[model samples]
Every structure is written in structure tokens, then in C-alpha cells.
Target: MRNHTSVTSFILLGLTDVPQLQILIFIFLLITYMLSVTRNLSIVILTLVDFHLKTAMYFFLQNFSYLEISFTSACIPRLLYSISTGDRTITYNACICQLFFTYVFGITEFFLLAAMSFVQYVAICKPLHYMTIMNFRVCKRPIFCCWMTTLLIMLPPHSLGLDLEYCASNAIDHFVCDANPMLKISCSDTWLIDQMIIISAVISFLITLLCVVLSYMYIIRKILKLPSAQQRTRAFSTCSSHIIVDSITYGRCIFVYIKPSAKDEMGINKGVTVLTTCISPMLNPFIYTLRNKQVKQAFNDLVKRFKLLSKN
Candidate 1:
């Protein structure tokens, strides 16, 4: 019989084994990380400094951008280090910490997105009552709830992982210390953990997605009823960017976590995870700023301020 012992550290196999490809991957990820940081930080700063962006929509967007920065930071730096140094090993405790924070940020994003959808619904459907309904006090509640609820919801699965025995091979076939990869390396039966993950993912995904869908449905109904065709176009334009972001974020996430197991498709899983962790953060700020005229004006205003300060 094979002796079983707790793993002290894990070896991350990373995206590719080829040395040449690793360099290319490192360059790609470094550029992506820098861009993600710059774009998200710009959004947060712009939202704070620009009076025009103080509405509930920008408030939610700023929080979401901050979350994106944090979420990408939690994984990308470590992945970059591993790629650069050819050191794929991570301490077990570090892996657990990474896993915990990743889920917290990821789950919080769903709630935030739903909250943003609610803001859109109010802005479009009840324009007259928008300010009254989505005041600062009201906006703060959902943000707080998103953070608290996700923390509580994620604690169980993270704790469950801490209890599992990892006697099997410690080589993880992905760049990040995600739950599925961690579970795959555990010698102990993870049927319970697997079920827990599925249940949590399903409930969270469905509830948030339902909220977004319902919000958009009501929005569409309201838009269609508007007498002016131009008004309908404007309403649809406001939502199109959000819909794009939602599709990218939820589509990849559902593909990864909603399944019974992702262990079998390590290659595809890694690609999708790269999109979620690296690409999503980079894309979100651009989507919001470039697609929305208000944000573009805000950004341009900020630039002019900087230029004026420099001249002074």
C-alpha cells in the first residue's frame, strides 16, 4: 500500500512546458498585468475625482474596477514569478490563501454585477425615481452585502479544503491554485467537496444571472414602450457594454465551475482561467470607458487637469 502524507507544497505545471513558449507567455502576461492595473486604477481614480461620475452607476463601476484589480493581482503576480523563475512550487498554505481570496473576489463580482444591473434597471425604468431609489445610502448597502455574503459563502469550501488530505501527487496542472486543481491532487475522497462547490457555484451563478436577466428584461420592455426611437437606441447603447462584460465574465466562469469536474480538461481550463484572471480585468475598464461617452468625457477631463497642473 502507498503511504499517505500531507503535502507541504505544490508544484504548478503552468501553461506550457516548452521553454520558448514560457518566455512568450511571461511577456504576454506581464503586458497584460500592467495594462489591467493601469486601466482599473484609472477608473477608480476617475470615479473619485470627477463630479460628473458620482452617480450610482459609476459608484458601482468603481467598486467593480477595484475588485478586478484585486482579483487579477491575487493570481497574476504569482503566476508571473513562477513563469519567470521557472519555479512552479508554491507552499501549501500560500495556495490555500490564494484560493480563498480568489473565490472571495470572484463571488463578490457576481453580486456587484447584479447590483449594477439593478442600478441600470432603476435608471431606465424609473428615471424619475432614480435618484431617490439609488441614493448613496442605498448604493452602499448592496456593496456591503456583496462583500459580507461572499466572505461567508466562501469560508466553508475554503475550510473544507484545509481539512482534506493531500497524499497524491502535488503537481497542479494550472497556473493558479484553484479549487478544482487542488481537489484533483488530494488523495482523500472529495465527493463532498465537489458537491459543495457545484451547489455553491450553481446557486450563486443562477441567482446573479437571474437578477441581471430580469433587470434587462424590464429594461427592454420599458425601452420598447418609449415613443421615440432615438430614446430606445440610447437605452440599448447604455446596456450593450454591460451585456458584453457580463457575457465574458459569466460565460467563462460557468464553463469552468458549473461542471461536475474540470480535471479532465486541464488545457481548456487553463485557457479559460487566463481569460478570467488576466483578460477580463484588462477588458472591463476599456469596455466601460470607451463605450460610454460620459466616462470618456470624464477621462478626457482628468487628462486636461493633469496637463494643466504640469504647466503650472
Candidate 2:
């Protein structure tokens, strides 16, 4: 076991080793990051200020916006710094902390989305009980539970990371540290830790998948029983967003981390990992919130309120 005090830093093996492409990536990522911040922050503001958006749905969204902000903050700034300064190195302690938070948010978000889907399923499928079930207190608990549960379940991964001996090659294949990548750099035999991580991740992923699948199964059955076209349309509209976001997050995540590296397809796997961490967080705000009329209305009202205060 390597003493934590002895290990200093790590090197990132970013998207392309090519200097020319680094510039292009920086430009593209920075723009996407900026837009994501602006959009999510806007959602956060609207959720707080708009009385109409005080439902369970927007309550969950407020947490999502906050996570998306921190999620991007965790990696994008480091990527920008690495690109501009050619400083691909990070202190080993900082690298592990980053990886932990990234994993925390990813897992938490998976279950949060599942929780949100179930909430919608209940609201649409059991309209009589929607208000009783999804009150403010009831609503926030599920999202918060996801965060707490994710942390509890992934304790082993964190323990492994904390005690890791990283005396070997410090060069990480991605700009940000992740569980698989961080484990790859361990100087000690990481088979136990790797199996622990894979088992936990698979179990977490499967549980979330089951929650979403069952929620939608119930939702679909409910939707079919509805006689009104408008009711069915509304139900489809709510669930469709979940289907899109889940497909992106879980689809890419499964591709990236599920396969053991002894059977690795490095190129394809790496691309999927990047998409999950980098691309999906940016798009999630849009897919889940921006297209909704309620969100748009809240935002517009916020702008109008600001302008009225300015005139006063």
C-alpha cells in the first residue's frame, strides 16, 4: 500500500495527442460548457421564482440543474487548462477527489432520473393520487435519497481509490479521472477492487434500469386505458423526455464501463465514456427541461419580472 503523502500528481492523456485537434476540442467544449451553465442556471432561477413551477417535477429539476453545473465544473475547466497550457498533469489527490464526485453525480443522476420517471408515471397513471403522493416533501426526498444511496453503495470504490498505490504510470487516458481509469493506474493488484467496482456499478445500473422499465410499463398500460386523446398525448409527452435522456446516459455508460478491459475495445469504449461525461450533461437540461412549456413560461415570466423591476 502506497502512502497517500508520497504520491504527488497525475498526467491526463486527453482526447487527442495531436496539438491541432486540442485547440478544436477546447473551442467546442468551452462553448458547450458555457451554454450548459447558462441554460441550467436559468432553470434553477425559474424553479425558485416561479410559483407555478412549484410542482414535484420542477423540484427534481432544481437538483438536476445544480448537479449539471457541478458535473461540468468538475472536468471542463481542467480540460480547458490542460488544452491552453499543455499542462496535462494533475495532483493525484485532486484527481481521485474529482473521480469520486463524478461517479457520485453520475450514479445519483441515474437514480434521480429513474425516480423522476416513476413520479411522472404515478402522476399520469394515477391522477387521483398524484397530489397526495408527490407533495413537496415527498418529492424532494426521492432525489435526495438517490444522492445518499449512491454514496452509500459506492463506498467500496471510494475506499479502493483512497488506499490505492499509484507508483506506476500516472498518465490517465482521459482528461478527467474516472473509476476505471484510476483503477488502471494502480500499482498494486487491483483485481479485487476492479471486481468490487464492476459489481457495484452493474447492480446500480440494473436497479435503475428496472425502475425505469417498470415505471414505463405501468405508464404504458395506464396510457392505453385512457379514452381521451389529450390525456394520452400528455402522458406520452411526459414519458418521452425520460426515454430520450435515459437512452443517452445509460446507453453510453453501459458501453463505456460495463465491459471488462481484458476484453476491451478501447476506441469505442473511450468515445462512449466521453459522451456520457462530457456531452450528455450539456444536453440533459435541454432534453428534460427546455422543451417543456412550463419551463419556458417560467423563464419568460422571470425575464418580465426583471424588466419590470428595472423600470421601477
In order, candidate lDDTs are: 0.89, 0.80
How many clashing pairs in candidate 2?
0
Top model number, TM-score:
1
Clashes of 1: 0
Clashes of each: 0, 0
- TM-score, candidate number 1: 0.96
TM-score of each model, in listed order = 0.96, 0.92
Query: Candidate 1 on 8-36: residue-level lDDT in tens?
Result: 89998889889899899999999999999
TM-score result, candidate 2: 0.92
Q: RMSD (Cα, Å) of candidate 1? A: 1.8
Query: Candidate 2: what lDDT?
Result: 0.80
lDDT of 2 by residue, 182-253 (tens): 677677788888888778877689888888888888889989889999988987887788788878877886
The window of 10 residues in a row where model 2 has the poorest summed lDDT is: 256-265
